[model samples]
Target chain A: MKLIYRHLGAIKIVALLAFMVFVCLPLVQMTLLAFVATLPHEELEVGQATLQNFSGILTDPNLRAAFGNSIAYVLINICITIPVALPAAYAFSRMSFVGDKSLFLAFIAFRITPPVVLTLPVFQLFSALGIVNSVFGIALAHCLFNLPISIWILQGFISAIPREMDETAFIDGYSRPRFIWSILIPQIRAGIAVAAFFCFMFSWVEVVFARILTTTNGKPISMAINALFGFQTDIGLVMAVTLASMAPGAVLLFAMRNHLSRGFRIGQV
Target chain B: MKTKDNSGWIFVLPAMAVLGLIGLIPLVTVVNYSFFEIFILSSRFWVGLEWYGELVGSARFWQSFARSSLFSMIILLIQIPLGIALALCIPRGRIWIGLSLVVVALPLLVPWNMIPTLWLSLLNPETGLLGRLGVVLGWPLDWKDSAVHTWVVIVMMDVWHWTSLVVILCYSALTTIPAAYYQAAAIDGATPWDVFRFIQLPRLQNVLLMAVLLRFMDSFMIYTEAFPINAGGPAEATLFLAVDLGEEIKAFNYGPSAARSVLYFLIIVTVAWLFTKAQGKLEEKAAP
Candidate 1:
């Protein structure tokens, strides 16, 4: 107890308090605003807390469909990103191909490519393909950018695992698919979890491409939340929608706060 | 180290192909469009760097560029050191460790758009804490109209939104340091300040560099929040490069927009490269 207090006494108290305030402020504001009725001038009425806002959002078919679209897109994004990413990660981690380093860098380069910049070309192409305003279109758009990051991060994790595992699996008569699914995967389970979480998070919260690609039927929660902006601002509904959109991520992060911190700490590598 | 399949390309080919068609191909198309003059349906001519020249010559583009750099710089100035300080404050063990991490991790889970909205209301003079306090203190604080205030709001919004990233990164890096090193520092009679300077700061170099680069890139490319608040209002004062490029894309001025994007891409790539190079040197010096 003396040892702990000696080192952490003053500094720990200050940091812990500040950090709690910092983390809690926005969330508390968001949660509170989402529940109450708006005052006359776009403000939350101090005494008007209710679950009516949640009911208002849930009952709206458009909001429901938007929720559906978001879920579908997130799932599709994970499916696309993980399968392709796993193989590409393995290749980059293990293979000696021409321009492998350059190719990997190129993938990293795409991760940094601004969606605002890429929006035009994708808009043009998807418009031509008649896939604009579709869930698949948004999924494709996300997968394009996110695939590289998945490879980069997953490659790092995959590389850290021993190669002998693969050899041993093969020698035990495991096929390539079986070896990967049975042996290689379990070794990098944490990596897969981290990578998949990020992939889902990015796809879930991504605005620009999702906005650009989907028109009505496939509109995501981010875009839908933006649509809450009426001429006379309904701060309550807007806050409710925004809070609803952010809830899953907030909950997930809270639940897996340690993993999330470690993932960020390690540079997602 | 999985070498059972030399045909790993077979697995990767599908993904690379899709990414190429959607991601890389469009970029190539953007580059191609930048170099050509296109008219309705049937007119195409080699413009040969004309769009690039126009982009460079435009005062608007330069203004937006300057704004972007300024925003990124201010965010870095505030977030990096603040993050380090916050990381330094947290107690290092399992119980408080879990609680401390959960505390810092909260801000990051909020979506980008909600951040500005929350602040916009929180600083509203009627019901907002900041706004009501400002009124009581007799300082007429208006976040929307004044350019300097807009900068403050944006900076605050960014700091609120992103500092968690830095804190988490630094804390993660800090936790990985072996306990014996710190114990040794203490045994050597190192003060808390001395231990942090000599040990913690050195260990944090790589993660700090990563934090800086991520923050710079994200802040520089900021669009959604800035657009919603002032909509680049009050004579384009808050019109960062993203807003300017957004306008071009909105107008369907494909040629010039593509050119500007290419230029933007090159500039960022250059800055990131230089940053990484400097970080490499720092990492070398800080090496144990």
Candidate 2:
């Protein structure tokens, strides 16, 4: 018991320091390089750094369109996923059906299925549906990946609440929908935020569907970066775009800062 | 704790329908494709499991599969412990907690495909800041030249990108431990290991299952960063199954790729099923 009691705090500090160095090095390097490389069409100087690449997000038509497309798809995916997942999670926790358990478990199975497997089939289906090459198509395509996990997380949070919350709400003459909205939703705000955060993150970072579905038009920022790498190999512009891609997620993580910490307070298993 | 109601299906109905269109139907299509020799969608001729048969017998398929399995195994072994350790080390002090969480979650926001681009810049020996630093430290990586070095960088990149998830989850599990429990441990003069083994580890079990499953499935299906990293270079030493599948898809080998997808998907689904079953057991144990 006394073996390491004296050095525990020091150990934690050392670990945190090591983690910070390891986690931040590549990112820091990227930030440094983003300044050094010149933007597209800019004549390279021997040692002069450039801020022109960061401004490319606003100035470049493809990048601007890609950013807009990426944001719209992410918002659409969350809107579709959260509303769908919430009700399913609510039912899984509060109500019992014949195959409810199996159905819930089935969601996880689909979630684990890789996006690569779904590419050709998704492209084929969307082309037939005529939603191909649109942000909406990419949004819907991401649902297959994000919905299951969102439901899983929401169900865990929902189940953690006491059953009495439901019983009392019902006895007080609230309808099932009303109870879920006013009382239940607020109570699980953190879960919803966590789920939404995940959905946003997944849709934002996903390249397979973004690449496959948006071949002709409506490319997301990831594809835009891919284009830059393929065509110009501009390190500065790529890092700038990559950093730009992270902006929404950073804002979201800050928004989720409190809720996320509290989100899993009930345990998400 | 719950009521028996068939109307619950009403709630599940929307997700079911959406997923049916997006998930189920595509899956069915893939399964259908696996049995055919596709020359464009319309020109596919029925081959009756020929692609799967070939995949099973082919040495190339098996070797890539074996290589991918080995990579997943190594990362899982490294990342799980590393994640748990980092999570434990995350101080709950008021000032640092929020910033730490935001920093930890930063990598998850980066597009998965660009991880390679980011790493490539960092590993460019002449130009990259990190690459230059490595040289200055007198330990330079032959990242593009050696298969072993490429593997190490890949592993390191994954650890950097993913360990935060485990830390966040473990933090949650730790948060669930009440102050009373800590006070009790303090009185008992329990060692750090004892607290971890008894109080913390028990709380972590549920989430660790989640973490392990997520890590396993992701590491198994890793494609985006890996494909772009070295493009399966250094004599094809890093041709993971997913990367190999990517090559097949890019080459327009539709039938074989679809078959490979089917085989690949089944492996994941089977593991997820087992995970679900195990989770059910854990829930049963935890119910009381």
Candidate 3:
């Protein structure tokens, strides 16, 4: 029994180490490549690493515009998603109304629908509306998916708060909106953080809709990176830009690690 | 807790309106356009089920569909069990738990486009770490020429990209299982397999179902990551349904693309619905 227990411990450690290596190796390789001055195919002198790749990409006018547009659209997406989804999620969690069940399921259906299914139609619609290639338009297009997911996650959080709290607040002469703002919103702060993180992450990373919905006027970083692929450019510069784009999400993850893990338990996202 | 007052509709109206305008309307438009032969932005004539017929009859469509299904299946088989195993190995202590989760989740945060770019760099024969390792192992690592190599790269990339989602979900679920259950198992002298089968697996059913559904849906619609790497290359051996649909859209083949899009939507919804129904039945059986 003692020998068996010792072997099990050894196996667990080995497994964990192997898993860590698998997860980290690719990322570490890419990061190292980003810092190198010369391509690995060219002379990979040990001390030739430089910040030139990062500086060069950051200063490029087109790349800067892409970065700005991506950040603008992602923020807009989160802004639109939160206000709209909060009320809807509250309604779904706290009240029952006609067509509630079916409507909620419709949102799930929308969530599962491939963005490709809606891309052409959305493009045509946006073009007709004269909002194509604008930040707001791309954000609105993203809301088609993000709004539903935000509601889904927010509803889960809202539902977990006891119903009696609402009744008690009502008895204390609080108006519906006031109670929701002052009492309920404070309680689900972690949910909002997680939902916002998810919205930001999804919008920031999404390419298909962003690709189709915007032209040069509002080109996102993903599209810019893709365009770079067309040109025979430096792989190190592309990797550097890619690493730079990952910063916002990495920071968000570290800051909200506790809320996210907790939120996943309650929400099912 | 049911309210007779239907005033909640007012609260939901704004969201519903937005969803209607963006989601429902576009969906309806796609359904409508599936019947039309679009020649230009303004020049379209009603074809009425002709495109659907063509889609159904096309060998290419079926091939892409099968390829998509196979890719999803392969990833599901690998990622699900692998994710569960990784989640199980995560230390239950506080600092290790947080550290492991953050590290595991890092790949998920990388933009989809970058994943392919990153992998491409990492697999370049001359300089890439994987390519160097491949050379040392004396293996043929030509992703551009070999279907098998492309498939392997795609699968490995996907597993690297998404298994973290399953791990996070399962880890969260595992944490919620009370200590008392494990204590009870220990008192009963349960073997590790018996304990897992009786306690952990049973507790994990809901999360596992969720993980399976999300993985299936996302992997089935995989586009951005795989598209950049090879764009379904090596003689189109990796061309998935999304990539196929994307090609039609890129080439401005609106009619057939719309028809194919609707069909793709139905397949996903049907599979998801069926999975949910099956899970419901299993839950009923287990509890009763």
- DockQ of candidate 2 (2 decimals): 0.71
What is the lDDT of every predicted structure here?
0.77, 0.83, 0.83
Writing each residue's lDDT as its tens digit, candidate 1 over A46-155 gives: 44887777887889888888888888888888888888899888777777666665676667667777888889889889989988999888988998767986786677
Q: Itemize residue pairs with steric clashes in candidate 1.
A: none
iRMSD per prediction, in order? 3.4, 1.6, 2.3
Task: Give per-residue CA lDDT, model 1, range B1-288, as digits (tens).
Answer: 224444766766876787897888788888888887776425778898999999889887888889899999999999999899888777756667677766676566555666678887777787676678779987566556678877777887788878877887798678767889989997998877788888888778767876787788888999987777777865788888888788888887878888888888888778878887897787677664
Question: Candidates' DockQ values?
Answer: 0.46, 0.71, 0.60
lDDT score at residue B279, model 2, on the 0-100 scale = 75
Model 2 lDDT tens row, A184-237: 999988899899998998789998889889888999999988888654466777
Runs in model 2 deviating more than 4 A are A1-3, A39-44, A265-269, B138-141, B275-288
TM-score, cand. 1: 0.89
TM-scores across all candidates? 0.89, 0.95, 0.93
Top candidate, metric DockQ:
2
Question: Ranking under TM-score, best-scoring first?
Answer: 2, 3, 1
List candidate 3 segments past 4 Å from native: A1-10, A39-47, A267-269, B1-5
Q: Model 3 over residues B1-288: C-alpha lDDT tens digits?
A: 756558888888889899998999999989988999988858999889999998899998899899999999999999999988887788767777777878888888777878887788788778888888888887576657888888888899999999998888778777767899999998998876677688877767877776887789889989888876787887889888898888889988889899988999999999988987898898899999
